[model samples]
Target: MSEDVLVVHGGTPLRGEIQVRGAKNLVSKAMVAAVLGETASTLYDVPAIRDVEIVTGLLEAHGVKVSTGPEGELVMDPANVTRAAVDEINVHAGSSRIPILFCGPLLHRLGHAFIPDLGGCKIGDRPIDFHIQALREFGAVVDKRPDGLHLSAPNGLRGIKYELEYPSVGSTEQVLLTAVLADGVTELRNAAVEPEIVDLICVLQKMGAIIKVHTDRVIEIQGVAKLSGYSHRPIPDRIEAASWGAAALATHGEIFVRGAKQADMMTFLNVYRSVGGAFSVDDSPIGGGIRFWHPGGELQPVALETDVHPGLMTDWQQPLVVALTQARGLSIVHETVYERRFGYTTELRQMGANIQLYSECLGGTPCRWGRRNFLHSAVIAGPSKLHAADLQIPDLRAGFSHLIAALAAEGTSRVYGVDRYISRGYEDFDGKLAALGARTERP
Candidate 1:
């Protein structure tokens, strides 16, 4: 695919409803789960993202019959999984972090697997150490080859107790996939408790897997001899919802986000309200959703921080920073989860935001990663003028932030790399922009 660009005319109030599709996180995992079943599994409401395509390519390489349904749904049959070719792995290796999720099912069915390097956000050094170690705990012998990682479970997987030092989503997903088919029960402590994990667990349970979630960040999985194909809709993308909410706040506009769940966005909604953003939820609407708006009031600046699940997500930091730029006073943002998250703020700086990076937190809250010599703090002195300029999107949330910058800017702005992968999560983002009255067109 060639690089695509977005030309956006600025200073327009976004006013309309945008429907969010299936969660990108869930659909990818559902594709991974399809690898375990012999029959065809159909996944509906799947977004056409590059990462999703990459995962589908990986599945096809592993000898699965993958096809698109008439309704834009995804169909997968893993009956001939033994036809997995190592050379075909190159096409999808290093495409996404999701490909590594195949380790568990592949090991269970074939007893050996080869995983290429993983690719995703570049916010920090997202090492797969936790994943490798967790797989080892499940009796998988892992070896780092010059090409990629080689894994084998000669004796078959046996349940073992493993505790993670940090609750990483990818690491937690690796453990869950590997543990489900072990010979005995496997217990994972300090597991990531994100909504995506919850969805994955539910999908696994639908396939006859025995899994239980506890309040203490623990997950117990009982080894199942086999799992059937599943068909389910994944959770709505909360991160995407937060991005649209940030766009509404930054432009001081009103927008209704359909399919945005209140339960999934509790942390972001609370922060939105704290920042003087107004929102209302329709519990019994035709389908149920929420509307977020600025309501022509003074936006409040907040001292915020990012954390793992149940905390301010690091992915939301970049887009929310755009809203913080429109706040009345100083807004201090501490990015504790990813050290390099503040890199996108540099782009926002060029758009006329008064944001300064700091090596330490001004507040007394000592962050575990911040104290270790990372430039983990940002101070936004806002109510500043933003001007449109040529911008390039480096990542997902940063892409949304640039979009907000374009909307808040005074003139036309050109954004490159937009078509690279933005639709993976946004789902007809350009159409949403048009509905909102933003002069958005592709070039």
Candidate 2:
């Protein structure tokens, strides 16, 4: 049996309760932030995902002593943070996009950094132009190399005013990690205020950085001469939480997601309600969770769009789209965030989903992808009866969506490359599926 493949006996509703810890999006970046600190930093409730492992390995490569606590607690010491060992080595052979984020902090501390080509989920064209420009604005010298990117702060990093064409979360993170220790103040406009980004800012603040979030998506960071480590518990995984919520809907099951927060999931909650999926929030300090269920009725479809933050998140779009296949009427999804997000819809169509992709923007909001000749929008006509088939997992979000489709479809589905993609984000996913009574096995 190969670990890359999975056998999913579909028609099993994912029931029972599963707990999510700190967000995958946050925990990995927070680990990178520890390299920016002078002393050791402690983070609690970290998930055991492959991304975290990659980040831990990258940190160790830079001489950061990372240790674990009883649970998912990690303590990182950057006292011996070193210049990257090899100028040409690609960390994790480029399995992560996070390596690009290290350019800022590494330049600030070691005066230079060598980042190999970065790799992440192939959802769309996520370029690093804004990130490079922002770094250049901070007075860092960048040289493009065959192996990867080489960055050096010959004149040292300084604060600068920068604006993004889009509210890109990665660029915002690059700026935050660099600006916090630069000279003078940094004002960023049209920034990404995603909950994960805000939480990352808080982590930096705990490490003795001063940051202010003002009106109109503006974030100001006052550069400090020095910063110590921080002790923090990151926000729970909202993306994963929403995935389960959508899973419950797709399979007509009920699932209680522990550590799911209400405040962070307002937009998703509203959409869940709009789709006729029922959810109740329990905001207890301990053992709190969101109970999501099908509520024994036909799932309603609605027009949906993906945006940066405070909008329907792009990550949640795929899984929920699976649920929408079972909904009454048609569902319009305008993917404003990623130009090629509808790629997974093809697999869904193969599973008997009545979906059509469009190059035109399906909604009133014309996104950057419109008129770019990309089929970024989708119209799903349902409730379509889905049957299992041989499937291949593409990227992370789409992989999870494929898994959800397989779980919700009739008969069984053979899904390949689950170990590579799904484990990168979802921790203990197979175990969790088993606990949820899903018959998933490695074949």
Candidate 3:
């Protein structure tokens, strides 16, 4: 586990049970929500991913006391909230983009906030212009500095009616975190309505915030005078569940992912079934999860598109592509979410999968990247015999896809930089791989 290189013996179908905790996307935001509260907040079923660690560090630097309780519960006391030094914040945040989220809460708590140079997965250019404009609209003075961004609310934050050009989740989150404490009513048009955003609204409600979700991607938030803390359990990690399901398909194995709720994965489940994979949902009182397997038949190729929530997730596309490589015919994937998401296909092709990337939109409606010349479309022609090859970990989801390909391939494969990228999202991935009977060694 100490070594960065993982030597994986291939052609073994992974079979076993692995447990998932809270949604990595939601839990971190909930932790950030704690900063807006005057009292302490408690979050349950939190994951052990590096993003959580980064958020915890950022909170602690701002004088929030974060402590762990029994069974993955986190207790965060914002009683002594204070601004942290820029260098210290930069050092602790590493490459995570979570620190940018602190701008809203910190502006309310201490009238000023500083964000270091932000970094995240290299999938695409995730510009923070939307966030800056949203904050500016709320009456915060934003100044760009050499190191990072400095934001100050001299006249205090006042809510304003705003509309997003595109329904970006990060922009929605910024508005939510800021609007909860601003003056007057904040109306956001074309807001992101993802389940995680809904769950975050639930968290805000528990803190005495008044928010309303209207139809047609409109959300209205009425600002309040003061807020208290909240105690809540976060939603389960749907992305992790889908990743495990894809692993089962690629390796021709069976995996029972405990804590994978079917309600959160309906879209992914539909796609998994359409690909000729077999799965059954179990909702017993003694903990429930989904079991996925290959079903010992020719896998069906599919024409897929990545979109916002309620559509196929961009994060789920990569691992499914690995499984699609084993399908009997041609498979098409149109990535409408992130333009550079198909970059991982090159590594998959190196492992003997017939994957071709193109700039033109394929198999779905034209999107933002349609005429941008980004290689966002992929055509994977398969039942291509996979062979092990040395692979470098790219981003989080793509890294997991490479891991699945290595496990499904013949001979041994060496995976490097996993500890840096994959560990950012997946919790104890090596331990889970071992539990699932993957023959792996750190060297």
TM agreement with the true structure for every prediction: 0.96, 0.98, 0.99
A best-first ranking of the candidates according to their lDDT comes to 3, 2, 1
Higher lDDT: candidate 2 or 3? 3
lDDT for 124 in candidate 3 is: 96
| Segments of candidate 1 deviating more than 4 angstroms | 1-3, 70-72, 362-364
lDDT tens digits, residue span 1-443, model 1:
23488998999878788877678887888889888776778888787677678888888888888999764588899988864666788677655777678888899988988887777767788887777888887888998888888999988999988888888888888888888778899888999998999998988888778999988899999988888888887887888888888888888798898888899899999999999999999776456788999888788889987888898888888888999888999999988777777888888899899999888875557776656777789999978899998888887778888999999899999988787658645677777898888888876
Task: Give the Å shift of residue 197 in candidate 1.
Answer: 0.6
lDDT of 2 by residue, 331-391 (tens): 9999999888888888899999999999999988998998999999999989999999988
Model 2, residue 299: C-alpha shift (Å): 1.3
lDDT of each model, Cα atoms only?
0.84, 0.91, 0.93
Clash number for each model: 0, 0, 0
Model 2 clash count equals: 0
Give the C-alpha lDDT of model 2: 0.91
- Summarize candidate 3's per-residue lDDT along 83-109 as a digit string, tens digits: 899887988644798888899999999
